[model samples]
Target: MRRRLSEYGLFFRECLRNFHATGAIVPSGRFLASALARFVGNGPAGGQQILEVGPGTGAVTRRIVAQMGPDDQLDLVEPNDRFVEQLRQQFETDPALQRVAERVRVLHCPVEQLAHGKVYDLIISGLPLNNFSVADVQGILAALTGLLKPGGTLSFFEYIAVRRARALLSGRAERARLRGIGRAIGAVLDQHEIRREWIWPNLPPAWVHHVRL
Candidate 1:
């Protein structure tokens, strides 16, 4: 209970400090986390290499860890210093996470900057795509996809109708930005989406987009 509250407090502060990067005001709910973890380890292949991007306070990562196999390894890429620190601390102190902590790695950097040589079989992301520019979203998606091995899966989420709702209350510029992001995401989904799940229990509802390459 204390851990969960601290996560919310830290996430809210990060959101205020940088809305563009932090994106959401709270950590992801369990339903969304479960949906996103669907492809972790890509169906018990054992030696799976998994990657997680923007795992704020590891809300979703907890589910990812649970789905991991003994031979699987996990890599986390977080851009926020505070979040990175929290992840490191969790691995070191949280009993639920300590069991697999040695197999997990935390890096303090954006997903785009991660080394491409280390391809992954499954990649899950908690990035708030609606808050980024179209070009930024495109680049991020491309980078993530490029880092996947053949038959790999990339999973990410976006709040349900968030862009549309925001557009309705924003000025012309903000609306344009939102529309562009929609198109960017649409193009990718049209090309690679193998499955999608609607997580109705999330804070504001969300859609988990799963792409297979």
Candidate 2:
């Protein structure tokens, strides 16, 4: 009973911390983390270099590291300073992570500015696409594609909402408009022969876009 209470307190504190940092609420459940772990575990072994975008609170990172082999590398691209600090502290004393720390690189910038020059074997994105503009999404997609190696995969999970109804119910666009954005992104990837998969297990569910280049 005491352990459970301690865990709940930690969760609450983390949620409040995330809220203050991103202006968005922390995830209410662990479904998305589980989904991402399952996806990584089922992916091809050749995808040794993994790139994660927006690893809030290191939930997915912990899972990714667990699934990764010794030779595998994981790169984290996060824009939130507070979350980044949290990630650094979380993994700092971890031996498994330390053994491969050289292989893990954390960037304190937006996903669009990552400049490793080499393409990644797999990219897992947790960015809130529904909150971004079409152009913003396009730029991010373009950058991601540019960073993907031939036959590499890029996956993303996001809320299904079309607009910021909870925050600004008045500025919300039509649901069709939101779907249009998703379709547009799909079309761009199809042009490059990238396949996509959508999953509905997350809170509000999510669309997981997978592309092979």
**Which numbered prediction scores highest in TM-score against the true structure?**
1
Question: Model 1 clash pairs?
Answer: none
lDDT of 1: 0.90
Backbone steric clashes in candidate 2, count: 2
lDDT, candidate 1, 1-213, per-residue tens: 999999999999999999888888888999999999997755555578899999989999999999888898999999899999999999999998999998999988999899748898899988888888888989998899898998889999999988889999999999999999998889889988999999999988999999988
**Candidate 2 lDDT over residue span 1-213, tens digit each:** 453354345445755665433433544245666556554645555547789988866667777887777567788998877667766765676675676677788889998988869777888877766556667777888898888888777776656553435444443454555555677576766665444445566556565556666
Model 1 clashes, total count: 0
Per-residue lDDT value at 81 in model 2 = 72
Assess each prediction's global lDDT (C-alpha) against the native: 0.90, 0.67
Which regions of candidate 1 fall more than 4 Å away from where they truly are? 41-46
Q: Clashing residue pairs, candidate 2?
A: 150-213, 151-213
Residue 186 displacement (Å), model 1: 0.8
